[model samples]
Target chain A: MGARRETILETIQQYVDLVATGSSADVVALYADGATVEDPVGSEVRTTREQIAEFYGALDGLEQSARLLHTRIAGNEAAFAFELVTKAGEQTYTLAPIDVMTFDDDGRILSMRAFWSGEDMLVS
Target chain B: MGARRETILETIQQYVDLVATGSSADVVALYADGATVEDPVGSEVRTTREQIAEFYGALDGLEQSARLLHTRIAGNEAAFAFELVTKAGEQTYTLAPIDVMTFDDDGRILSMRAFWSGEDMLVS
Candidate 1:
């Protein structure tokens, strides 16, 4: 929905919205073709366009919100500190951590590496 | 001593050596022009080539070692988790935090943002 480097901040916000709305395809488009996501508990999840579409399809009745606390941008990379409050199935989880996101010069998110602790997830 | 991208890891290692040896000039060259350094206590220190050289000239005696615990690289960006053990003036300080370094396509470090706590600095 936005051009390169012009709406980077908004692009990330859009992805957050998609997650909250349980729309994974929208979230996945922000990434480059060969994109990867790492979970808090040292899990590496690779995503393809089709896989992302299917993953979101499974989270049918989930409600989620990603609250952005702070954002720092320099050149082609941006770091965001955010909290994810999500309710999937019958339980809710809250995760607060900082994530480093790298964008290609064209503003497409090339990779996203999230940093958080498993202890926090367990407590949440 | 290395080419762009080929020795990104070695380049950072070299900077760590310069710090340990109190060779500020060598450390300063790793930064791009108009580079900035921030302290854990919320101080933004911008450095120019000349200022860095002068600063190193003053540190006649110092011993330091930046032991890298982990490094993650993706595309043109790299993040390093390291501990800086230094003895300067009559004091020794140990700072352990992960720093995100962005390198230009040419392998020159454009920006480095280190994430550490001020509390750690005071204790060390």
Candidate 2:
């Protein structure tokens, strides 16, 4: 991989690490001012920074964790597939999602879209 | 990886190979009867086998090729990121896309969604 591609992958890995660690603020900080996020593909896009932060914040109470399975980077875009597990009450839920992200020149995310459907979620 | 996961990856690799070889019929055969395809994320979803076949057929003239970059499989779902290059006239275009596919119990594809934007395309 080229240095630029390596850098983009590193940035994405950092974002994933923040998500796994429940660092909502750090996750939000990775986005550009006008960045947009659309989780689950067909959802409404969150445009403002505050909205984006709130979106990540919602996961803070879930005791969420993630494991990266694969990653690919090209230009300023990177996509990865990972498993996300969250504990809520007495139940645990698992989801496998593929997240595609585009970064600005400064390595801040311009957009993030996660592809997964309700059927892909497992609860135990 | 389990045997099932390996099989799923093999199926996906076959699908990618067909796309690279311009085997539209083979590509369509990989899908279930009512399989859907949504290319480029927010685009209209193509339902019905004929619609999906026509969609793949549209790429037959492009002299397209694909190089897989990363793949992840969980349950009956698999997602991969790859570079797609096509030659048209005197120009060559390259695009990096992440495709998420769901398979039924029989291993036929139930849906395929490609995540890519116009900005991800490069022409030379």
Report DockQ per prediction, comma-separated: 0.06, 0.10
Candidate 2's error at A21, in angstroms? 8.3
Model 2 misplaced regions, further than 4 Å:
A1-14, A17-97, A100-124, B1-3
Q: Enumerate residue pairs that collide in model 1.
A: none
The interface RMSD values of the models, given in order, are: 8.9, 6.8
RMSD of each: 10.6, 9.1
| lDDT per residue as tens, model 1, A29-58 | 777777666543145465666765565566
Tell me each candidate's TM-score: 0.48, 0.58
Candidate 1 local lDDT, B1-124, one digit each (tens): 2235456677677766666674666677777777655433134554666755565556546666777755545445566656678776788888766567667666667766765544436333
Which tens-of-lDDT digit does each residue in A39-73 have in candidate 2? 86657889998889889888776688888876656
